[model samples]
Target: MAIDGFTTCLWFDGQAEEAAHHYLSIFKNSQLGHIVRYNEAGPGTPGAVMAVEFVLDGQKFMGLNGGPQFTFSEAVSFQVRCADQEEVDYYWDRLTDGGEEGQCGWLKDKYGVSWQVFPTELLKLVTDADPAKAKRVTEAMYPMHKIDLAALRKAHAGER
Candidate 1:
């Protein structure tokens, strides 16, 4: 019973391998892991990909070709804690390719996985002890697709 970490499982219709590769391309410190394929079990096409294991940014994930019974929603999202605006932009641009952007630094990738890409500074600004500053920063975030750290800072400072 040595649980060091948890592996997130992503359910896909039939694109587990493709999804794994797509994620691997985005993260620099990532690599492919084991790939399991269906055989005579007959759940999926014989020889078709059943699951793919991959590590992205040191976190383990599994993509399962579990058919179309389930889907990803905004309720569950991966948060990318960026060091600065540049990191935020990098992730936002890459993840939003062939995907949809949502308000407040959220986006759904081509594989329909939701992600929150925001600067780490956002947490500090929005949690400031000054209630008005915190409120302003949070309000400024509402209309943003990709977070603008400078804008958030301005809002936090009550600058026009």
Candidate 2:
């Protein structure tokens, strides 16, 4: 069952169920919830999936087997704030598998969903009170696709 309240809806070209399962497999605390199918009323073939509701680590999202009319865009993205380098690497690798990677910790999942797999230390380093530390870290990050936490930490501490 979908928990009541705001739920993000992702439009897919017939891959809603597949994407839901993929996400469920990746996130430890997530689950694939209720699914709805198209009927003879016919936006899709009868008995085919029409939508799916899933929870990824407590975040609710609805996937619509909507068709080729709409597509995922980078204007909106899911940000995964990782606890450390391991978490960042885990998400970055999985999310970028068979998908394109973007600069600065962002990548498109195999299903075209944009995700930011970032280390929590990034926020701390980037927002540090020392302007030089923050700038160094920021500059170090802008050129990278998958975040390198060790490098960022070095830059933050004024080390090469």
Candidate 3:
């Protein structure tokens, strides 16, 4: 494939390859592309992974072994929009496995990558034209970990 256009590069301390494999295993349409290793370079030990090219559900990404100088923060996150509660549960469970769950459907993977696994219904409910319904949905979501679509729907309908 031609190396061009936009692609996200995820920086890791020394687990680029491992993270790539883990991501590929989690997403259905994911695959690993080129994996480059460090030679007798001064930056890293020989045979250590330098960078890995991968595709997660069709989005191209590069995992760079940039050492421990930097780490991932919750400020940057990939949002996965789900059509239903099942999709939300699937991504939430998979991404949060051996990881941490944040408020309002956000989570951090084992590799410290932040992600938002939420259903589309939640968005619709929260953005409703009715201020009361929208406020209820927002209030209900504030205390959620992985997001409860059913609860959001109920809140949108003004039900407790």
Superposed on all Cα atoms, the candidates' RMSDs to the truth, in angstroms, are 1.0, 2.4, 2.0
TM-scores for candidates 1 onward, in order: 0.96, 0.96, 0.95
- Residue 141's lDDT in candidate 3: 95
Q: For residues 1-160, write the lDDT of model 1, one tens digit per residue.
A: 8987999999999999999999999998999999998999877789999999999999999999999999999999999999999999999999999999999999999989999999999999999999999999999999999999999999998996
Clashes of each: 0, 0, 0
- The full ranking of all candidates by lDDT, starting with the best, is 1, 2, 3
For residue 140, give model 1's deviation from the true position in Å: 0.9
Which ten residues in a row are the worst by lDDT in model 1? 37-46
lDDT for 69 in candidate 3 is 90
State the lDDT of candidate 2 residue by residue for 25-144, as single tens digits: 889899889999999999799999999999999999999988898888899999999998899988888888889999999899888889889998899999999999999999999999
Weakest ten-residue segment in model 2 by summed lDDT: 1-10
The full ranking of all candidates by TM-score, starting with the best, is 1, 2, 3
Assess candidate 2 and give its TM-score to the true structure.
Answer: 0.96
What local distance difference test score does each model get?
A: 0.95, 0.92, 0.92
lDDT score, residue 57, model 2? 91
